[model samples]
Target chain A: MADEVKLFRTWSSPFALRIVWALKLKGIEFETIFEDLANKSSLLLQNNPVHKKVPVLVHNGKSVCESFVILEYIDETWTNGLPLLPKDPYERAEARFWAKFSDEKLWLSARGILFGVETEQAEARLQAIQNLQYLEEQLKGRKFFAGETIGFLDLAVGWMANLLSVLEEITGYVLIEEVKFPLLWKWMQDFSDVPVINESWPSRDKLVIKFQTMRDSYLAGKI
Target chain B: MADEVKLFRTWSSPFALRIVWALKLKGIEFETIFEDLANKSSLLLQNNPVHKKVPVLVHNGKSVCESFVILEYIDETWTNGLPLLPKDPYERAEARFWAKFSDEKLWLSARGILFGVETEQAEARLQAIQNLQYLEEQLKGRKFFAGETIGFLDLAVGWMANLLSVLEEITGYVLIEEVKFPLLWKWMQDFSDVPVINESWPSRDKLVIKFQTMRDSYLAGKI
Candidate 1:
């Protein structure tokens, strides 16, 4: 009823959940429309014609696509909420660099280990470890990538909290070890402890089931 | 002297030039240290250890890497000049979307045509045209991507002004035509017509010489 916020998303999509966490953190209530990734809804297609992907936040009829962009929009619109970005321009740029880094370098490496062939998986595992180490260094002196608060960068990379464990279980590749990534490991725990995120996040069981199916399909050459 | 801004860049780099234009548009005077790509300066390596690439803006001893991030940093830091981003949240998101689109989709396609093998070049040419058409539709009635004034999106896609011609010269693949992309053609001219851009831009003959060498190297398997 308030601002007619509608989120076009898929339940299992970590990208879409980023928007969900942002919206909840802002204390803005929105109706969620779950989408089938295989057959995207016309509304999603019409709203986000370019990517045809989920997590299109349609607020008062206008659509904002891309999870990070959507998060920025939500932060700007609801100025009263806990701020997602820093007030300082340089700090904001630093936050942005890390968020882009998380997406550009981190996610792909994790995906490779999860779905790649044997040799590829081994290479990807090393890449993932190196990326995690960088994240560990970034998180060393701070509670979150954005400092003591849960901010934009944390939410952007928060999927690893649950997904990493599920991936480890499925692939038997223990990437994010506590000893190796103490800061990142603590950051993961701190990120999941957020009430809204914990509430909105898909259960580990849900992710495990879906990922297992995906892995089986990939191994069988069906996907 | 004022906050000590230094830019690490190369003369021929489009990415580095983006920072140059941003700094110019803001009227923020800075010294440029040209770096040879083959033998990158230790300062460049130290500043942007992740990418080890050009166009790192160091202000007051702090480094901000990535062209778009630097642009945003400049816009936010200096509020006196023509604002690069729109005031409204939605408009800003739209601008960001297109900027990302131009980088993710358009750049790859242009690279494909410029340096990719024959088969890859043909496929990439089609992709580039389709992307340009989408951009043309976006520029339908507006004078600029950010309405009447040149902004981030314009700067993001400004390479077509100089580089596209050189690419066409080298590959003999003409992707942007006046007949098909009247709006974009006009936009390109308007972008290049900017006093700051025109004044600071590298000569077309210079780009031709550079790209000719690059194309030859690619064909000879020397790259």
Candidate 2:
């Protein structure tokens, strides 16, 4: 098709990294344009006028916004590659369900613990632990959330492997501890072992400094 | 492989209607179980342990939660009748982008106007109007959001046709007026004329009564 694939992304964005991992896993070559979210570029604005967020995958001049939507687009377009989702309709639906859960519940609950006010932080910690417990039960006897090998569900939840540790450093609130969620804790370890993911994940120290400053500003009411 | 199709839905839920319309559009026969959300059935709790919400499409045995996800699943599972999404990748992404916007932005904005407190209602009205303006622009040259047919984006935004009018009667605010959003006003008329949609849509009078009571409860701080 000769489509010039380009990705508009920002550093330290877990959403953007999901696309990066998807493209890498599918062996697609794409040009990455780092956008300054503080002062968003004209390209990002034109591509995603609605959200004005990053991780816009531009293929042949058309852009696909939203992380999970982009992953579906990639998988569909590059049908020749290792399938991101399972072939069975039921299994595919389950994978989509978990991917959405990872976005709506897992990410939001974790955010509450990291930067929420005092009461919010307490409630969020309880909810986060509850969500993780459910996930741990689902992960029983499975190597990954997707099972057997890394795929859509694995990529969707993979942010937990890196971001959870970074948040622990920034907020001193430990999650994925072996005592509470042994299965998910092990799953995180197995998720990171994949070469593409291990090589491309952001540095923990860098993320810590960034999130620490962000949390401080949030508490100070500067942002 | 004769697969049995079943849908767990609530009569008053616009979300569940989306799945209903989707199945009817594809000519797929299914059984509907009306759920009492106040006292949820064990089937709903067991199938959708996470959200416990309705519009869970159970095909054969597995259930798919989330209305938009269920629509995609139905489209993929039954590849007959009419296609929900366009075949082109870019067009499909655009369809998904709008479908998500209908959820994240439009629904919340409309809710803000309908049920928000004094100050919130004013702000929500402005946001809701602005969102309608954007959609109006998108619909300037198109009969439907998905072009000539009632497809994914149409189902996603169909709530505006029924719910918007109900909210207007409850709150005395008129949206999608011909003067303000001419294209959307016309699109609303065009959308309802579709035999499948018109036949299955809930009666406006009944919905008005339901929402009026609900809004009173909300304003009285009883909800």
Candidate maximizing DockQ: 1
Error of 2 at A209 (Å): 1.4
lDDT: worst 10-residue window of model 1 chain B: B214-223
Best-fitting candidate, measured by TM-score? Answer: 1
Q: Write the per-residue lDDT of candidate 1 for residues A1-223, one digit (tens) a residue.
A: 5699999999899999888888888889899999998999899999999889988999999999988889889989999988999899999998888889889888999989888878999999998888887788888789998898889988899899999999999999998778888998888888888898799878779899999888888878944
Where does candidate 2 clash, by residue pair? none
After superposing candidate 2 on the true structure, give the runs of residues whose Cα lies further than 4 Å from its correct spot: A117-119
Candidate 1 Cα misplacement greater than 4 A, ranges = none
Model 1, TM vs. native: 0.96
Mind giving the per-residue lDDT tens digits that candidate 2 earns over A1-223?
Answer: 6769999998888999999999999999999999999999998999998889989999988889999899889988999877899887777888888888879998899989888867889899889988888778768778887778888988888889989988888777898898878888888888898899999888788898998888888889944
lDDT of 1 by residue, B1-223 (tens): 4778999999888888888988888888899999999999899999999889989999999999999999999999988988999999999998888888889999989988888886888999999998888899889889889899889988888887888888998888887789989998898898889998888788889899998888788879944
